[model samples]
Every structure is written in C-alpha cells, then in structure tokens.
Target: MHEGEGEIHADWVLAGRALQDVWILPGIFHGTTLRIPDAARHGWHIFWSDPLHHYYGRQLGRAVGPDIVQIGRDDTGQATRWSFSDRMPDSFTWRGETADDEAGPWQLVAEFHCRRAPA
Candidate 1:
C-alpha cells in the first residue's frame, strides 16, 4: 500500500485452514462498498472510500486526484470513474452512461462467502 492508501482483506490458505487480512498491495486503495444480489452466485460490490471526509491522506482528494475504480478477477474488466468535489457529499451516487450501438451488452456473475459474525 502507499503511504496512506486504504486496504482490503484477502483470504489465504496454510496447513489445513485459511487466513484473512488486509490487502497489502502497494498503491491500491481500500474499497468501501460491498453490494450484491440475493443470489449466492451473484457478483459482489465494493465502493471506494470518499476522498474528503473519508480517510485518504493528509491532503484531500482534490489535491490528490479523482479515481476510477474497476472490479475484476479474470482477464475481463469493468471500469467506472467518478470525482469527489467540494460541492458533493461524502456519500456516492452511481450514474451509468447511455448505451449506444457501439457499446455491446455484457453480463457478469460472481460468488462470495456470506458468513455472519458472532453476536
């Protein structure tokens, strides 16, 4: 991770069990949102942190730069770029682009472990 980059957890296997911890990939930001459909096999979601009120670094997101986040596992990739301006709130709003004939329809499916923490 960078000097102030956020982190995400990654699972690991050792011996006969698995381990998990914050992602240590350098320069990668710790995404914030994790949304998905009710289907067990549906793809999951992860929202990036807010550049301003959210903990990024000493300098605000403006001083740094807007970020375009992409979520993918295989060679295929999907990307959406957004900016955090002073006029905007920390909360995020997703806006899709107008699909054109040039743009083809795409579909994705994903699976994730849904284990609830103890009360």
Candidate 2:
C-alpha cells in the first residue's frame, strides 16, 4: 500500500433501526474484513485505509474520505449518511520507490461520533 493518499467518499444502506452502534472503516482485498465484530445482520460498514499502489505501478486508495459518517434510523428503516469534508483525514500513506522507508506508518487516527436511533 502507498504511504500517501487523498480523500474519498461512498454511501451505504442499512437494514433496520434496532442496530445501535455504527462504525466507519475502509475495505481491504475483500470488503468483508472490515465487518463489525457483532453488528446487525445487515447494515452499511464504512471504512478507510492507508493508500496502496495499483497494479499499473500507480498510486491510489486514499484513507481520507468522508468527513462525518453518521448512521441513524427513522420510523421505517435505517439510514447512513455523511459528506466529504474539505478537511484531510487525521493521517495518510503512500507506496513510493523504496519498499521500506518507514514514515511512522500510514495508520492515521480518526474522530468517531455515534448516536442512538430515534425511538
């Protein structure tokens, strides 16, 4: 994966309103890896990851996407909504010529804001 990356955004549709906690993480070789530990049977699992290099020897996949990822529920079903803020993610990474330069790791920290669904 690259040690440097830009920002990205996406959307997700959840299952029901009963689901309480919501988390946002980027996907991996397979999206399933970012699944919540014990989340509802069906819901959107958002995520971001350190940048990675593409097969074309180019850089892509920036972990900095979406500003405030909010997942909530109404009377009918659940909803996941958020906008890509102008702000950059807490951290980033990119793959360059050196395979191992060591740049404090692309593991940038993120701010999480979660709330309960309406009753």
Relative to the true structure, how large is the alpha-carbon lDDT of every model? 0.29, 0.27
Which of the numbered candidates is closest to the native, going by highest TM-score? 1
Q: Whole-model lDDT, candidate 2?
A: 0.27
lDDT of 2 by residue, 1-119 (tens): 42222223223325532222222243422111122222342333333232342211111122234432223221223222332244433432211222112232223223223222334
TM-score, every prediction = 0.21, 0.17
Residue ranges of candidate 2 with Cα displaced over 4 Å: 14-34, 37-119
- The segments of candidate 1 whose C-alpha lies over 4 angstroms from its true place after superposition are 1-7, 10-30, 53-119
Residue range 45-64, candidate 1, lDDT tens digits: 33334333343211111112
